[model samples]
Target: MTEEPVPVTRAVDFGTAKLLPDVDRARAWLLTVDDAPQSYVDLDDPEHLEFEYTRRIAHVLESAFDTPVHAVHLGGGALTLPRRLALTRPGSRQWVVEADRGLAALVAEHLPLSDPDITVHTTDARAWLAAAPDASADVIVADVFHGSRVPAHLTSVEFLREAVRVLRPGGVYVANIADGAPFAFLGSQLGTVRAGFGQSADLCLLAEPGVLRGRRFGNAVLAAARRPLPLDALARSCAGDAFPARVVTGTALAALTRAPVHDATATASPVPPDGAFTVG
Candidate 1:
């Protein structure tokens, strides 16, 4: 009989990091920091994305980009998406910037990525992006968080501008945001992305119906690009997920707007209530 994997815990720079094994899937693990679920990875099945938001992000990439891509990921939690990208898009070059050095090291030692194409940097996401050459990436994925909240610095128009500079023309920028109905932060972020990219960029949001309707605190995946997004394909992909989600754009997106956030006004995303996203 196969041995059951045990949980491993370590004190990282940001918080206590834990790796909890999936009882049903021997090679699968869920990475959590301070009780908030971070990333779920099935080492034996890179195509399997356990988180709804992760699937939504993957849908955007799968729908929009057919060939290999030069991708930059702001958060590197167990390198889940990087592994998926390596499997789905062979020859793709990926760069992952994770701020928590100790957490990065813990993941590296425990998870042990096999893809040589993916390079992990132990540094702040914003600083790394600011230094990146213009038009250096085909896609940028922003999913960084300190514990449960997205850092204030990463939520501003300035940050989006840096993203725009790094992305090649027509490249996509996708972010995983957490909020509920009356999505002030989410709206502001959308506005910031649009304002940063100007009038030419197209944007959309993918989220569950109830979450969009103010049912609960949850994740929302937002996508933007200089070119038109594959909304039809994205809608279908999101709807077919185990927990169905809807894509909002055009008028729906326009209605959910807020003044663009600047560096001076930015703040970390709102904290969740007790028991929210507590790992079982």
Candidate 2:
């Protein structure tokens, strides 16, 4: 087991994050969490990012709505996806909720998500989720995390209920989860979201199913709405230049909401194999 993290207070540009090195470590982040200063904690791993999968999310959401959708981000990691959305669909309203006050400042300067349109909120992600400008946003993203797990409070059944409350009629809820090694955290989280969203489809790495590539779990962009959102066309259409991959929906979405992880064999099929299988 790795030693507990040493407190970090010094400020340094952590490459992609642009936030202080201390901020990362305190919350058990890459620059700060567990043991070594592994690159995955430093934003070196593109695969673990919301941006890597945002375009696909955007592609699907765009199809769901006739116009640009209102969006919010719970955890501000370099604001990659937010930046992408603002760029792809100009004049869009976005709110980014960051827990770490300093992280907001760091991303304000460094991360690529500096659109004058996006409003950055510095507060507990859950509070902001409830207090956010009411039924104004069309999408609500809750991707906040501490090391691998979302702070337990955030994942509690009650909190998810709150998330369902704030979302628009067909709003999309996206979550980025980290499940690796000997834990079923990923699958369980998937179950939690599935229970909440009612509709979800995974956006995982382009690899074979059940393959635990060490720290390489997968992303579950779970989307749900009080009313069904138009997702098929979104999944079929190619996202413009800025975004890549088609939006996945139907079985794909269901898979994300109810993704299965094979525990009996210790190796299972892809959580949401729809997108991958359809393409293959």
Candidate 3:
């Protein structure tokens, strides 16, 4: 099968990326930044997730709550997850905090969100979370990144605390972190989340088997909540997914959380080496 050409391309503040349509699917579009896959959108089927990490996050959101919820997204790359949320749970109020105005505008003009409940704001994710009222949202998602690396401020304990503070009782906080083998960055982020949520909070880590085993560089979905997460349901969801993944909680999560906690002085997430994700 031939790959679909990107009909539209632009140079944004950070780098250059393009929206490439799926040759087989008329409504599907894949966004890539500097040739690295960033986000995928299926306008016709928001429930159909093309990326493994995104599928994990969607599963968490589905298992986290049964009713429509108020969600705040820290990053807005293509707004794929947000669009899925709006479709799966109608009437849900969603807010997106994105720092790239040009990119946001590009997505708005090209793949405009049909959900009136979804609002986009161009600002720093940390600043927005800090200014948000306490216990104001049922879920908070952190997926902010600069190029391939997550910004230092977003990975700090202070940022996690702010995210937890904005979540209502029994609310969930989920973040998508990318790292390489040994997963030192992932471990530190887990520690930071654990510290912010405390021992009583339910924490779970989901990723591909290879990624979890430190054999590859990939994205991991870290989820935490003030109350117990529906692990049974989450596990079932992961199993049923098209791209099968694994969930680690309880003892395994504790082991991973042994890394040192990161504060405000922490630097950005470690960058993967050159060609880590490049196409052959």
Candidate 4:
């Protein structure tokens, strides 16, 4: 007789989410919150990034350095990217600052980061970033969000400055932002990152062509670095990706950075309208 699979469910502080095993892929799990898919993890294959935005971030990380480097992740959803870093760049030290302690604990209980190099802290990302020492991290990744909306504090110029301050010279800072047509929030964020990193910093935005065109609500990956970004290589990687994405930089990025800068007074990212992310 075949054995029945164990049911997986957890009650996080925000809401109830599930860590369902992928039937077709061994050691793979999908995390969902409020009916929205948040993260996917394949323990057997850490390099397999199932989300387009996540894939874009991974591409930036791969293009940033040839070997493992210290990284700080400002969100810990399923600890997906950190696990990927641990596997892809063995011995890389990583720290994750997640606001939802319950969610963090639940994820750890089910999908533990067996690697000793990755540590998860239950704290606000902004606070952690502010407390971090200068020039301490080689890479800083900001993927923090409450459900689908990123807190305003995390997007403000004040927050971006802390992120920039924590990075080593030539270190890269990457963030995942979601916005709809008009892209006011994304534009402002791009502007904020550029402003924080200064004139010499290289900035790049990556996302599906549709998202870039402001046709619908979607996630965009924004990367900024003190040194020149590897746009050529990143463009090639995105071009060949399963979910073909594009990179916007140079004059094109300048055009998009027209939005006003967001400061501490900014509100949380505008929430998507009902049905914007709903699947039929």
Best model number under lDDT: 1
Worst 10 residues of 4 by lDDT: 258-267
List candidate 2 segments past 4 Å from native: 1-51, 111-114, 180-183, 197-216, 237-280
Expressed as tens digits, the lDDT of each residue in 41-151 for candidate 2 is 223332233233444455545656656668887876556556656655667788888776765565454333435788888788878766755567777777675433356
Q: Tens digit of lDDT per residue, candidate 1, span 143-230? A: 9999999999999999999999999988999999998778999989989999999977899999999899998989999999999999
Of the pair 1 and 3, which is ahead by TM-score? 1
> Which window of 10 residues has the lowest lDDT sum in candidate 2?
32-41
Encode model 4's per-residue lDDT on 1-280: one tens digit a residue. 8654454777787776777778888788888766566788888887888888898999999887889899999988998899888878888999989898888987888787778888888999999988899999999999987877888888888888899899999899999988987888888898888778887888999999998887878899999998889998899999999889989988988988854455645778888778765422
Ranking by lDDT: 1, 3, 4, 2
Candidates' C-alpha lDDT: 0.93, 0.51, 0.85, 0.85
TM-score of 2: 0.60
Weakest lDDT window of 10 consecutive positions for candidate 1: 271-280
Error of 4 at 238 (Å): 0.4
- Segments of candidate 1 deviating more than 4 angstroms: none
Clashing pairs in 4: none
